[model samples]
Target: MSVVMADEAKDVHTEQLAACVRYVPPEDLKVVAQTYDGAPVMSGSVRGVQAHFREKHPQAVYVHCYAPDLNLVLCHTCKAIPEASDFFNLLENLFVSQCVYSQHDQFASIQEELHIEQRELVQISNTRWSCQLSSVNALMKNFPAVMKSLQKIRTPTALALHSKLSKLPVVYLFVVFKKLLGITEGFHKVLQKENVDLAQVVHYKSAVHDTLVSQGTAQVAEEIYAKAKAACRENNIHESSLGPRRKQKMGDFVVEVSCGSRSDLLNDSEHLKQRLFYPCINRMTSELENHFPNVEKEVMIGIQACLPASETFLCMQSLEKLASQYNIQLVPEEVMVTKSFLSRKGTEAISDILSVFKPLNPMMFPSLKTILQVTLTIPDSSCERSFSSLC
Candidate 1:
């Protein structure tokens, strides 16, 4: 466990890391990987730390924290839709103020009166998007009690907030985000699993975005709008249908929706669908694709090729690159010989082979053994697990 005190200076991060590494003697230390938060690793002074450390420890792989990356993706994607952004802000106030701290007793009293379990709202965090899921669940679970509490309160603030919460848009947004976050919450949890590797993380990222894109399809969009309208009807909440029609300007030609002949209520629902559901899904899919690029896929594919058991494993170019990365100078013939040997005898499971590598003679296959140790010893979800313990 290492504690790094962050400062603005670029050298400060590198100095602290070097100081820590100094504590452990040169001959005794073998750093396999370094996992850190994405922001500092990508844009902050930690870049210097990584560069300096890699100069001394060439085998160390730097991995961005998976959990924080996913959280950041969600936060950025949420900002693309006005409803989602507002939903989170409103939910933050409702959860943090009403259910968690300020008026928690009032909220609990209402829940008690309604004969429901007393549950507190989860507080939102700027850096952790998963907390939003807990907040949404708390809201949906105790919604009835929340409404009753607001209605019974005589204060102006409560009444104003109640007025907003009682509206069809607010309630509909609540339900929609609850459903959306429910899906995202699962993805978030999967990324934080101790056993999850970069390959699995990349797979989950692709699957999640693909699912979001599928949800934005026309048929699915209509189904979602229908559900929202049905919920509105069931609740007897009258939502406006006549509003500003969506417009598109193309090369001095103005194109706008002519809602003149259409039913106002239907047009309104369509507007709501366009504003809330479809855009949210599209934005999430786009943001995820943008944040988690195909380079990760390429990197994972390259790493998999280093596995001895893989039939499609390491080529000459890949072997050279891997060797260069770990500061292992390999002759072309050595790589070819290793590849030939593995092709003939690498049928054994990778884990079983790796377990025997250390005890076996390293001098027998120096290049193969060195590469295997580096690739196999790479940590998975270490950053998230470490952060969890700290919290």
Candidate 2:
């Protein structure tokens, strides 16, 4: 997802939002328009994204009516698009407020919509079998509906219904055996987890069991099932309510440096130079300790803010190179890397330059911090005249 400055963003995160809304286009539009129906294609450009959606999901009238340019759409749709004004329609229910939709937002839309028609025969068979016999009510309900609607016809109509069911992924043993006969038992464990409120019916289980039982290969299916359970028993799955734990964000702390406010007549010029940013540097270290874990005197973390467009980046780069050679990371935890003006220049931050060769967190990789020679770029000769006159 895209990260943006809130102030400049007008309290928005557009880039990240675009990722979630990318898949609103309906499938009917894709089929009707004949634009690569069910084909694997990547969205190559954003120039005509609105037009693309109109062509893909015409049935979703809202998308066609409110087509937006790339920049605007990105901002408006990063989070869930709720139907209700109260945000009730959002996938997240109450009590799980902290849990976001997903950090991997860009792929989320694609995965939710990119369905292939029973490409994996083994998986299809398993599902069909489950629908026919197991708690898979959706499938069982559909079969009778087909039958009742066609009851006016003779026995031939009934056979056609059977044919349709057999062709479905469930009865088609080839579908299950082809590619999808996998992890039935493992998936069952996930559904049965105490925390899960969703019903626990190992989908495709009955179908696979029935097919294998009929084929006299139930022994093989049982072995595969046993292995799946063993794997789950040994492994730990961590579904994050909170993504990765991180040190306090740089924005969370305020910058308060004790410096001489430009005194009258430049009276204390030398004194001011002696400690202009000394307090800030010390505070930086202290802030690092309070916010981050296992931070040393010099470990750096990701800069919360982007580098300003000026000479600051150059200054930061120099400091980063020098800091690299020092012995650090005694405790070795998350390292904070920030871009600073003193060592950076021209749209680049100290962290940006250091990132080329330095470790993300000095606390994690002491050796990642190494001193390197850096070339300095002062102003042209024209500035020398002003400097000399001032001197």
On TM-score, the candidate that comes out on top is 1
Local distance difference test, each candidate: 0.59, 0.24
Q: Write the per-residue lDDT of candidate 1 for residues 1-391, one digit (tens) a residue.
A: 1212121213323422212221111122567556554444532434666556667765555654566666766688667665577668777766645743546777788888879898877777765668877887887777777777777665677776776665556666666666677767778887766544444455567777777766676676566566655655654456665455567787987877554433222335566677667777777777787666322333355455564444446566665665666566666676566656555554553333244244434576667666555554443433344334233
Q: Write the per-residue lDDT of candidate 2 for residues 1-391, one digit (tens) a residue.
A: 0101010111233321112111111111111111111112212124343235546543211111000111122122222221111111111221122122441232233333433121101111211222111222222223233223223232453444433333211221212222122323333333222222101111122333344334333344443334333322332211112222333435667434325422121212232122221222233223322322211222211111112222333244434532342322222221223323134443343333223323234333333232211100000011111122221
TM-scores of the models, in the order given: 0.68, 0.18
Once superposed on the true structure, which residue ranges of model 2 sit more than 4 Å away at CA? 1-137, 141-145, 148-151, 154-159, 166-391
Please give the distance, in angstroms, between residue 281's alpha carbon in candidate 2 and its true position after superposition.
58
- Given candidate 2, what's the lDDT at residue 288? 25
Once fitted onto the true fold, the runs of candidate 1 whose alpha carbons sit more than 4 angstroms away are 1-32, 39-47, 57-61, 99-106, 112-117, 245-267, 293-298, 304-324, 327-372, 380-391
CA RMSD of all predictions: 7.7, 32.9
Candidate with the greatest lDDT versus the true structure: 1
The candidate 2 region of ten consecutive residues with least summed lDDT is 373-382
